[model samples]
Target: MYLGSQEMRTVLERDNGTIQKNLKKLTFYYGASDLWCPVQYYEDIKKDFPSGDIRLCKKGIQHAFVTSLTSSREMAAMIRDWLKDDLAEM
Candidate 1:
């Protein structure tokens, strides 16, 4: 069950062209902080999908924000708001 670098890249890397082609039909809300995963990844995604909702937490929230009840609630609220706004547009 251990996937090495190539396997991981194959599983994770998206074809930018394909994603761009379908971008109009997709709704995304991506959040990333500099604490765990690289902030540049999210930035790149924002660049690729300019219309997509992406939140970069400069305050350095941990990657495992859901481990605490308070953080989980905050995350849920954020998602709920995003969902509401997305639904309103459709």
Candidate 2:
């Protein structure tokens, strides 16, 4: 399965609530650089998801930085690298 990137239709419909709940049991490594999800959502999700490992990337830029190139590619890459590192620990 893909590490990230959910189906747009399901995401727009908020069908991911159940999946989000399920993911509560799994580790989470959020991009501190995220604009779309943001740190607020990450904090909220972490609150409900205490069972899993929680972390954030202390990098620069917005959420789209990962998928976008504009100056923040390195920051996004750092976030992705952090995710990989954390996942390996899991």
Best by lDDT: 1
Q: What is the per-residue lDDT of model 1 for residues 1-90, given as tens digits with 9 covering 90 to 100?
A: 355566766867757787778776565434454443576777788887888555676544466677978777877887788778878999
Q: Which stretches of candidate 2 lie over 4 Å from their true place?
A: 1-9, 13-25, 61-90
- Per-prediction TM-score to the true structure, in the order listed: 0.63, 0.45
**Residues 1-90 of candidate 2: C-alpha lDDT, one tens digit per residue:** 243555543456323467466774555567776756678867876686665567676655555654667647686565588678868989
Prediction-by-prediction clash tally? 0, 1
Stretches of candidate 1 exceeding 4 Å from the true structure: 1-12, 21-32, 58-60
lDDT for model 1: 0.67
**What would the TM-score be for candidate 2 when compared with the true structure?**
0.45
Candidates' C-alpha lDDT? 0.67, 0.63
- Candidate 2: C-alpha RMSD to true structure equals 6.5
Q: CA lDDT of 42 in candidate 2?
A: 70
Worst 10 residues of 2 by lDDT: 7-16
